[model samples]
Structures are given as structure tokens and as C-alpha cells.
Target: MPGLDLPAAATWGRLTTFLAVYETGSVRAAADQLHVTPPAVSAAIAALDAALGTPLFGKSGRGIIPTDAGETFAGYVRKMLGLLAEAAGAVRDADRGRVRIGAVATASEYVLPPLMASFIDEHPHVELSLSVLPRDELFARARDHAVDLVLAGRPPRLSGLVTNARRPNRLVLVGRPGLKTDPLTATWLLTGLGSGTRDTALSLLTRLQASPPLLTLGTSGAVVAAACQGLGVTLVHEAAVRAQLDSGELVSYTVPGTPMDRPWQLCTTSEPTSATRLFLAHVCDPGRVGAAAFHTRHRPQG
Candidate 1:
């Protein structure tokens, strides 16, 4: 049996080349990023295949498609690179006091700016890096120790993490200013595919069991845009549509007896780090309240 030399067994050059390719998905692009010639990138890949005893990429029309082994290896490579970057970030933070935060797009757009602004104003020396991702990515980044704090919806469950509930977000129905009230047959506007908004709309419709209504949009933005254009009624965040509602560009509707409340939560890994604690303090403060107050003030007096 040939003795395995671990150093030779793991192809570092090829791994670097592979990461560049996997990230950019183009050999030429990877070469450009690495400041190497295309032929050198190709050679590194070939060397990697020789060391691993497997073909990595299969040529397609113009670009290359990763083989199954390549696909699996790429996943690990991404993790490894992420870990390396995170370690470096941790070292840097120790020297220069910084906080890293991750958030889902909705939270980033609607929830974070004000709280983070206040945090920054108070602690300007604490550098901040906030990345916006989808839910899965947000949790994965938090789980992987890539970020110090995660601002997002409550995950179904938590492991190696703790969460604190923040101000809740209300999902409300919206329509153009002149929308007529016909409870029996109002054309319901809704969000597009693969969105939680769409899912919420579907659930509400199912619960309400109104006649299968029209499909007027393919995205949450589309739903709002269609509503603005007077196409149909749609569901949106009360805060997000506040300006339009106040300006008479849009109007809100209540679900009669059912209120849709989705709470936002801030999460941190177990053994809350100083950065996480500080961010949590800021986000959880009563002064950092969301637009719930706006909804309360505008709601018709009973």
C-alpha cells in the first residue's frame, strides 16, 4: 500500500483554483480573480483531479458543469473558505473592535436600519458589517459563526443559539385609494411565487375560504405595484405601505376577526458574545420600536 502524504494528498493550489472557479463558475473569471493565466488555472484543476483521482468539471455549451464529485467538494470548499474568513474576522475584531451582523432581506430593509443607526451613533468605534441574506442563508451564516448577530424571523427551532423576540410586524391587506368595498367579491391581490407573503395570502384565503380569487402578481413587489395601479387588493407590511396609505395612494383593510402578526426576533449563538449582547440591547430597547405605533395611531378609534 502506498503511504499517503497528507500534504500531497490535499491539493492546496487546486483547492484555491477550485474555489475561485466554484465561486465565479468560470475558469477565465477565476483566473482573472486570482491574477493568474487561464492555462495555469486549467493546470491547477488538472492537478487537483489527478490528486483526487476524479474528474471535476464536465464541459457544457460555453461554461463547464460540475460533476457530482465536484458539486459535493464545492460545498465543502465553500464552508472551508467561509470558516477561514470568519476566523480572520474574529482576529481582526479582537484588534479593532467590530461587530458582524446578518439579516434576512425583510429585516434588513424594514427593521435593521433604525436600530443599527442608533447603535452606530452611540458606539461609532465598533465597526459593523451587515450582510443581507434569505432565511436559510441567514441562519446558516449565524450557525457557522460567520456573523455575531442575526436579525430575522423566529426560526422554527434553535440549536446552539438563543433568541429574543422583538417588536412584531403586522401583515395587512392593501388596495389602491379608490378601491370599492365589496366584501362578497373583492378581487384579492396577492404575492408571487416562493414568497412567505404568497404563503400567508394563500393561508388566509384558505381560512377565509373565499372563492378562488384572481392571481394578480408573481412577487410581493408585484402585488404592491399592482395594488398601486388599481389592479387588485394585496397583502403587505403595514409599515411598508404606510406612506402610500397616508397619501391616499393606498388603503388598508382589516381581516375582520383575524389579525396577521409576524414577530421579528434577534438571535445569537449560545454564550452570547459581547457584540451580540450589545446589538440585542439596542434592538430590544423600547425606544427602537417598529411601526406598530403607526398602525395603532392610524387605526380607527373604536
Candidate 2:
């Protein structure tokens, strides 16, 4: 096994058995999970151990446990299996002309609906599924290939994904009319933790040495709604509250170094599906509805 090179098919089979045994703690239990005989499970593990030139498991009383090397190798096996499953899903979705998309709250609430409406109108045959989550969870789903694409603020450095900045995302501090006080002094209505809006608000507050928020809402819409009721000042995406700002229901404040700007990005796997590519083009095309909705700029008054 000095230069062991197992066949891909055998490797997958062996790894599958190894994972089952590692998880179940016994060959018989692994066989039960795989709908195979205990001897078959034992044979697969033996084959894997022989190929790797190392003992993967050690026998205990009526059970088995993975060795240190097996533990380290199991991580890679899980990733490989996950990738394989994603590949299968991608192929199925491509055949069915389906695209799954994940978006952060702001994009889901304000940006995607109009664009999706237009896209569906044009590409009526494409089946679409969209999930709106916090930025962190959205990125996680994108990285896992649970969604074909993700629309959100730019994610942190991720190795296996590609992020294209589709438009500018502007964050502004907003409050009701006649409430012109220091942002630090006013009660703050914030979105839940892990949202892009909340992250921006926390950063701005930190820079200003402001106190913690008085209240927290789960969604950006709720935070804006609370602010509109004259409850407290809140930092939110300008796109999310454009109608209120335009209607004078809420007024924007120009805090020092205000309007933190970031990019609204389209994130996808390195090898995106055809459906993903089609949707990305639709969003990026300047003449399309997505571009207009995403790129529209709003100037805030102090």
C-alpha cells in the first residue's frame, strides 16, 4: 500500500461503509443502516484499511472505535460524500430546469420579489425555490450547495465559492420625524444577530461608542416597522425602507461616517449549474428588472 490507488467506485463504497461503522459503533449496526450483512460491512472496512495502509478501527467490547487516523480521514470522507450528493442534486435540477436561491432578509424582502416576478414572467418554464435567511445562514447554505445561488451582502473569505458584486448596498440610520437627537442617545431598534443590517449597526455603534440596542426584532421589516412607529432609531438597508423614506414616514439621519456602503453580491459554487448561470445573467443584465431594483440609488439628507 506504499502508493495505494483505489478505484473511485471502490473508494466510495469503502468510505460509505467506514462512515456507517464509525457512526453506528458496530459492524452489525452499520449493516442494519446500509441494509447489508454484518460480514459485508466488515469486509468493506477491511478493504479500506488495506488500501490506506493503516488500521482504521480497533475492536472494543462488542463494538469498534475509529483510530486517530480514521477520525482524521472521516472528515474528508464526509466532505466527499456531501459533494457527491450535491452533484447528484445539481444534475437532477439541471434536468428539471430548476434553480434554488437563498437570500438575506433585505434582498428577499425588497430586492428579489420584483426581479423574480419579471424573471418568472420571461422564463416561465424554470422552476424556482427561494429561502430567505440571515447572512451567515444564507452563506452556509450556499457553501453547502443547498441553494444554487445566494443573494446577500458579500460573504467572508470562502474557499470554494465565487461572489460577484451585483450592486451597492447602502445602510442608513432612520428614525421618525421630529426625532433629531444623537444616534447614541436614542433607543435603537435592531434586527436579530447575524443579519447584515445588525452587523452594520453594531459596527457603526462601536465606532461611535454607542450603547447596546433597547430592542431587537427578528427581521429587517419588523425593525423598520418598529422605527416607523416612532419607537426608536434603527439602522437598515436603504432599499428595505425606501417607500417609507420616500413617503416621509421615516427620515434618514446623517451620522458621522454614515451610510456604510457594501456590495450586494451573488454567490455561487465554483462550478455553477446552467440554471444558476441563467438567473445570474438575468440579475446582472442592465436592462433587466433585477438590475434596476438592485442598483437604484437613494440620496439621504442629514
Candidate 3:
């Protein structure tokens, strides 16, 4: 046991590193998650431990385990980090700030609305704009700094772009209930070429070298409608098709390598502005937003 004296170890960087390590239980994993070197994470942890006069972690054979004290500290750390995000967002919105974001069709259309709503509710002074673009165009704009941030499914490896955070995403192969299972005989449905769902389907079909009768619908909604009418099977975001799937209008099929597991990445070019950072943090850390923000809207006033 060591003395629990609060000292100079309370710096923001160390707190962030500590939380990452506490959550991940691995220095290497925390470093990768924070986009920092392993040594940096180790140094921060060691400094924090020294300040508190106790080691936060202990070696458990081949793995590291959090100490009893470490677990106790984590409860407070979570609250402090949440407040940090809120305070930073509020202060950053002091100026008339603007941020431009580009995203793939699925992310922009289905994923970002609630997040944007929560951000707008919290930072009413901040102005936000969104652009829906193809994957290549999104990266092109991100590279040239035309867009401040991008949200999409797994970015391509490129120089100078930084991925700030990643969230889980799912792509499922959905069709009418008990529909034909033959890919060769079925008409493969597709949305616009800009759509990620279209890309996933095209990539799978390409790899399988099976080109069925193709139906090019313009939008995801329309494609889902066609699939409901038994036009063809389509790959789409699982969240997007949940209603139909639940009602027996649509059913997910277990195709090879699907439903595909993927990640929605938040990325940016060099040195994003404070506004962009605020939005990025808010979206990536959904728990950071207070529940009151969402409920505050459309509440009946006394």
C-alpha cells in the first residue's frame, strides 16, 4: 500500500493515458488507441504511480492486472474525463466556430444525425456542415484539407492522415424472408456507387467472380424497398434495415464472410481546429454527453 497524495500527476495527458491503460489493461494497446508510442504510455503510467506512491498495475504472469487502488481511482477518473470533455466543448464553442465534415453515404445518412443533434444541443453556437461523398472523394478532400474531419468505414492507409477514433459497424446481407438463396439466380441489388453498401457488395461479388443480374437503385431506402418487394438481396447497414428485418419483411442471410464486421473511423488531416476536435470527441465518446442534452429537447415546459 502507498500514500494516496494528490500531486502533479493530475495533468490532462496523464489522466487520458491512465484511463486508456486502465480500460485496455495493456500498455501497448493503450498506446495504439491513443496514437502514441508504447514508451510514452509507460512513462505516463509510471509518473502517475510515482505521484500516488503506488503502482496502478501488477504483472499477472503474461498479462497486467489493475491494482485494487487502480480500480477505485477509475470510478473518479471516468467522471473527471466526462467533465473535461464537456468543459472543453463549451469553451471551444465560445467563438463563432465552423467545421466541415465529409462522410460516406451510410455514415453520413444513418449514423451522424443523432450525434450531430447532441453536438448542436450542447454547442449551439457552433456551426456544422456535412458532405456526403464517395470514399475516394472523402479522402481526397481530407488530404487537401477541404474537409476538417471524415467519418467512414475503415480508411485507406495514406500518409499524413490521422485516425482519431473508431466505432463498431455492421454490414448485413438482407433479403425478403425465405427468399431464394442462389446468388447466381438472384438479382443483386445496389444503391448509388457512392454508397459503402454498394462497395461492400461489389467487392464480395468481385472476389467470388459471380456477376448476377444487377439492379442499380439510387438510394438505400429505395434499395431496401426493392428488396422488400423481392427484387433481390442487398448488403446494407444492419441498423438501417432493422425494422423490416423485425417485421418479417426482410431477413438476414448467412452468406460467406458476412454479415461483415467493420469499423466507423473518425479521421482528420494535420492539426484539426478546436471545433473539429470538440465534435470528434463528442461523437467518438458517446458517454461524454449528459443524458439531459437529448431529453432537454422537445420537453414540455412547465
Candidate 4:
């Protein structure tokens, strides 16, 4: 309520405009979505800045980008807007139950299916939707309230969100059978930019003093395929490439400092819906779903 003491109409307009700009990353795009002129959008943001007594956005390379303050404020605005939408929906149909979940490829392919099955069994009336996305995109979707909750790698620090660490994912360097272990000399296959696996791979390469990757694939599956064909070594969640590893199409190397233990997390808005809370409890409770089902599949044997 501290930030809500302003004139209601003006405050709502500016906040919504700010959120549109933040999500779209452009004044012109936000204007188009809001059905207003670009200049009008600029004016609204300027006025809002004046009211708040701090600059929220800064110019960056032919476009506007959020300042740290803007990013933080945008999170609050998103939560407020989401709560409003939920309130309206509840008024219309109080009994309606739904949840939208976004997940990274690792969790989506391995961890989510069984958990989702259990959730559906327990709460047959709840409507559920799951989106599989890369780590950065998953965080963006969660921040913008596009999904009620996101299950993925340990999320980066973002304002107005809560992260509940669930289980650990082990990352290993894998490649075609009989591949060399010298990372500096070996070609690297990696996921596209902004992927958590790609970040981890790069970090591992840096520690090993390796050169830049030779190829960047768009998905984990593609990386696995390329590795199987002797393209290059890749770092991936061990469970993701389990079948290939078992079939002898791929081999895992025990790189010093890996299998890196990256924790999986459940990220949600600071204020979660009742349905979202229920689903989180169901998934996070080890007695119900159990950590073994989530973490024990296809673990590498030394």
C-alpha cells in the first residue's frame, strides 16, 4: 500500500504503460500494444519518473531500457496487475481453478511429467498448462506473470519474486563414444546464448582454459544429437541425455569440478494464487512426490 497512495487513475495508467514498455523493451512496441502514439508513451513514462522522483529508464542503442529501479518497479506492477486479473476472474467464477507453469528443458523432459501426473491425480478439477522454455525465457515468463510458476535451474536474483530450491541437477561433459577429454583441444557443442547449460559449459571451459565453442545449437536435444555424431563435447544435465548414454551413443567424462550440482527451483510471484500455492506444496513435499523420483533417474555411475 505504500506505493499505492498516488492518484489512482494516473498511477494505474503510468504503471501499466511502464509494464508494457518493460515487457516489450521498446516505447514504440508498448505504444502499439496500448493503442497510443509513441510520443504519448514517452510522456507517460516521463511523468511517472517525475512523480517517483527517480529515472526509471535509460536510452540504450536506439531503444529504451529499464534501469535497475525500473526493473524492480516493473516486478511490483506485474504482481499488482496479475492480482487484479485474478480478482476479476474470481468474482466471475470463484470455483475456477487453474495454474500456468513454465519450465526449462531439463525439468520439462525429466522432472515435470511425473510431478504433473501426480498433481492431476490429486486435484482432478484444476486446470493446468505447462510451457517448456530455456532458462532466461522461463524467468522472463515468470516475471511477466505469463506463467504462475516456473520450475528451472537456480534462478537469478530478480525483484518481487520468490525462489524455492527443490532438487539438485548434475551437469556433466558428454560427447560421442571414445571422445577426447582435453577440453582445450576438443571442439565444443553448446546451446544458444542465454541458456543455463550454455553458461555452465562456458564457465567450465573457462576453468579448463579452453577456446570458445565451435558450434551453438538451439536446444539441448540438438546439442545431444550433434555430440552423438562426433561434433563436439557438450555440458548437459545428466538425466537429459540418459537414454543416449545408456545406449552407448554418448559417453560422460568425469571432468574435475563436475558433475556440477545445480539446484532446481520453483519460482513464483511474491504473491502467489491459492492454486499456485497448493501446487507448489504438492510438488515440494518429499513425502508426497519424493526426491528420489525427481533426482535419482539416470544418475551417473563412477
Candidate 5:
């Protein structure tokens, strides 16, 4: 049969060299393009011809012309190479087409809405999914590769994670606008288990040497809402309750060493997905994030 020999030892190099030679119509020209010697190109073509049991080219002056079989084979080889390139791109497109972004409740509630909206507007084709989890759960998911990017207060140091962006974060004690209850003896609203806010709140209490009446709430939102209704006083991330503070729904109390500095961080694994990188770049850009995302003119008391 005047077809391929189907030798088990046949290598991809032969077909590629044959195609390169076919394209340039000269061994030396093909060798230059491939960054190999003319002898190497000729040897590749010879090996390919031997495997196929047919000479794929014929002499034409100083150049070469494909035989009938070589001409036919070039078609299949061209399609094969084209399909290979397409396959590679298809795999990468999947990664680039979707973004998995996770954040702690405070960041998601306060900072992410506008930033996410802008990101969607800019990259309309990307499918974005956002999850709001407790700080510990968020970092755990990051370790497991279940999520692409994370935003929260300075997370505990972990291997294989990188903090890509940072901004000032302040935790403050807040209550209803005109509450006269002394914070030292007032009921302290605390968040539920697995939240960083609870630990921070407790630590602040220890520092102040006051153990007020404690109320356990399931979420920061719940705690803040409870405080607003004059139920009790609560500790919250300033960014999380920015809207409330500005609207006079909540008042920051004056306390020594209040407004503790806990920086908001955007974190990702050492190796991140293509979509993650795109979103990371967007969030890091000051122009994209805008002043309202984190910067505010209102003076909050805490």
C-alpha cells in the first residue's frame, strides 16, 4: 500500500519537519525557520518518507515539490496541526471565561458590590460567582483550590497564598444614634461561630477590662441591625457598616484605641486561574475601584 507504514517508533518531529519543508519548498529554508540544520531537516523528511513507504517530494531545480501522496498527506497534517492549536486554546478559554471570587461577609456586603459591578461591566463574557463565607472557611476553601480569589481582613498566614492588594480596615463599636447606655455596661452584641469579628470583639473586651452583657448573633448583619434597634452595642468593621453610619442608622462610640487597624486584603493562591488574574488586576487598580469603594468623607466615631 502507498500509505503510512504505521511504525510504532514514528515521532511527531518527522511530520512537523515534513510540513515545514512542504511550506518552504526548500530544506535550507525550512531548517532556518525551524532553527535546525539543513541536514536535520533532510533527515527528518527521509525518516518520514521511510515510515510512509513513499518519497513525499521530488526534485524541482534547487527546490522540492511534493509527490501526489505528500500533497495529500499535507492536507491531513495541516488539519491535524490546526486542530491541535485549537484544542490548546479551548482548554485555556475555559479558565479565562470564568471567575470564582470569595469574600468574608463584611467585604462582600460593603466593598465588593461596586467593584464587582464594574468588573462585570468591563469583562462581560466572564462568568463570575461570589461567595460570602466566614474568614476561616474562606481561607480553608482557598487552600483546597475550591475558589479562585478571596477578599477579607488580613487572613492568618498560610503557605501557597499571596495577598495581592491591601487597604485600611477598621473595626469599631457601634450602636443606635442616641443611645445613652454606657458601652462599658451595655449589652455587647457578638457574631456567631467561625467569624473573625467575634474573636476581635472578645479581644477588644479583654483589652478594655470590661465584660458587658453579651448577645450572640448568627451574623454581622444581625448584630448591626440589633444594635440599630437599641437592642445592644456591637463591634463591626467600619467598611461593613459604612452605609449605616453615613445614614445615621448607627453611631460609632468614642473609645480609647478604637477603630483598630485590620487591613482588608485580596488573596489568592500562588498559582491562580486566568479569570482570577483578570479580576485581581481590576480590583487592584485604583481607577477601577474608585474612591467610594473604600474611601469615605464621613467621620465615624468608635
Candidate 6:
């Protein structure tokens, strides 16, 4: 039989079905969306194949995967769907106002709430969505248009974004209540095994000429917990474990001559939307003190 042709056999429904399976990568999942049985969706795929004279997907272990051709096609399909959604929204919407913000887990939990609360109070009608992710994920999401802004510790270099909310992060060493250390101890416990903190700690160690640390942790909170159990010494953000310090569960140690500081920032893509601008303005307003105010108001008694 001669190969079937697109003009003779194509339909919008077949394209929609193909795109659905392509996006989700499963026949059963596509079936769930169309409210049909898996076999029915498979039949649609068969019809689409006969019409295009090419296979779109291959069956894998309990799932479906798109062919290379289908993968390329799916990209265009997603673009089309996005454009369609945008067009439909443009026609029906009057005020398209929503800000999606991303932050690292620590910043989201400890730093962003007061800023966000102030923003919402200023613009009560604006919708807000906040995602608490890891450092890399937060920046990646901002790059990919998934979020309007990202707030995290300032990385060395970020492409396609501007540093707007910059502050000097106060980092300090913490140890158990009675764990004594000489001014020139060789051993250390570096918080965050990740590269940025590791590099910073290594530089500090190099300057101090201290030996490699006994432990390297992946989180400041873990460092605090370990110190509480008298595990070892670790460096971390002062704000992160401030409560523990005030309660005498952890105590800050002076680093002799080293200034304990790191830089933090709020980042947004170069071409920020109106929503992003509003959020940035509210968070960094000079006169609008939120968390900074709270910390100043209830500073721990010396």
C-alpha cells in the first residue's frame, strides 16, 4: 500500500493526542487525560502513525517513549500550546498580575517571609507563588522563566541576571558550649560540602594555615545539630542558628583576625516583567524595614 499522507488523514485530535503522549511519555497517562482506556489511546497513536508514515513512540517497560522525530515535534507542540494559552489569556484577562519567586530553602524559610509579607501588604491584589528550592535550582528556575525572581547567597558569577538585593551575609563559627579551641587549632569542621562553601572554607583555612577539617557537612543546620551533640566545630550563617545561640545550645567562636562575612543577593533576569519589578521594589524598599526591623527589635540580650 502507498504511504498515507498528512493532508489526507490528519486531524487536530490526532495531533493533540500525539502531543499529550509526547509531553507525558506514556499511553496510560495520555489516556487518563482524554478520559479513555489505554488501548483507545494506543489506537489513536496507530492511526497517527499510518497517516504520517512514521512511528511516533515505542513501548518501553510499562511506559511509552517518543521517537527522536517525536521528541523534536513535541518541542514545537509545547511552544504552540504556550502561545495558544497566552493568546487566550490576553483576550480574557484585564490585569495579568502574578509574581513567582524562588529562593533557597534557608532563605525561603528565614529571609523571604517578611519581605513577601510587606510586598503583599503594599499590593494586596497581586497574586504570589513562592518556591523553596536548592541554590542551583533556584537560579536555574529564574533562568528558565519559571520564576520572576530568586534570592540566595551570592554565587561567584551568574549569567543573564542582575544583582539587585545585595547584603553582607554574616557567617560565623559555632561550637558546643564547652568545646574549647586554642587560637591556633589545626582542625576544623567546614559546613556545606558543596563547592561554594568548601572553597570559602578552604581559602580561610589556607590563610590560617590550619589542617583539613575533621568533618565536612552539607548543611548549616546539620552543622548546628552536630555541634549541639558535641560532634565538632563548623561555620554557618549567624542568622540560621541565632535562636540556638541565644538559648545557649550553641556558642559563636571568634576567628581571631578573619572577618566573618559573605555576600547575599536577590537576582532577577535582565528583562524583568512588571510583576518582578513590583516584587523587587517592595522587598528592597529602604524605608520599609521588615525582618531587619524584627531582628533589631528583639535582639538577644548580651
Top candidate by TM-score: 1
lDDT tens digits by residue: candidate 1, 1-302? 13434247445566779978877889999999999999989887776677667878988899987899899887676666555655555554342456778876566766678777877887776678889766656667676666767766555254776665455567788887655665325777765454566666777777777664576566556677788887778777666676788898987767653346765667767754555556666655666544421121222222
On residues 229-291, what C-alpha lDDT tens digit does candidate 3 reach at each position? 999988888867978988989988866778787667788866777788777767655375543
Per-candidate clashes come to 3, 0, 0, 0, 1, 0
Using all chains and alpha carbons, the TM-scores for the candidates as numbered come to 0.74, 0.69, 0.62, 0.68, 0.64, 0.64
**In candidate 6, what residue range of length 10 has the lowest lDDT sum?**
293-302
lDDT of each: 0.68, 0.77, 0.76, 0.77, 0.78, 0.67
For candidate 2, lDDT tens digit of each residue in 90-195?
6754434777888887888777888788878878877888898777776666676667788887664667777753577678889998986776788889888777
Better of 3 and 6 by lDDT: 3
Give me the runs in candidate 1 sitting further than 4 Å from their true place.
1-20, 31-37, 40-51, 92-95, 156-158, 181-192, 210-222, 256-258, 271-273, 286-302
TM-score of 1: 0.74
Q: Which pairs, if any, clash in model 2? A: none
lDDT preference between candidates 2 and 6, better one: 2
Estimate the overall C-alpha local distance difference test score of candidate 4.
0.77
Q: How far off is residue 144 in model 1, in Å? A: 3.5
Find the candidate with the highest lDDT and give its number: 5
- lDDT tens per residue, model 6, 147-230: 667777765255886766665566677777776655236246655544355456677777877775467766666667877887
lDDT per residue for candidate 4 within 162-194, as digits (tens), equals 775456667888888776557556788888877
Off by over 4 Å in 3: 1-95, 288-302
> In candidate 1, residue 256 scores what lDDT?
56
- Per-residue alpha-carbon lDDT of candidate 5 for residues 102-152, written as tens digits (9 for 90 to 100): 898878887888888998898888788888988777776676565677888
TM-score of 6: 0.64
Residue 120, candidate 5: C-alpha displacement in angstroms? 1.0
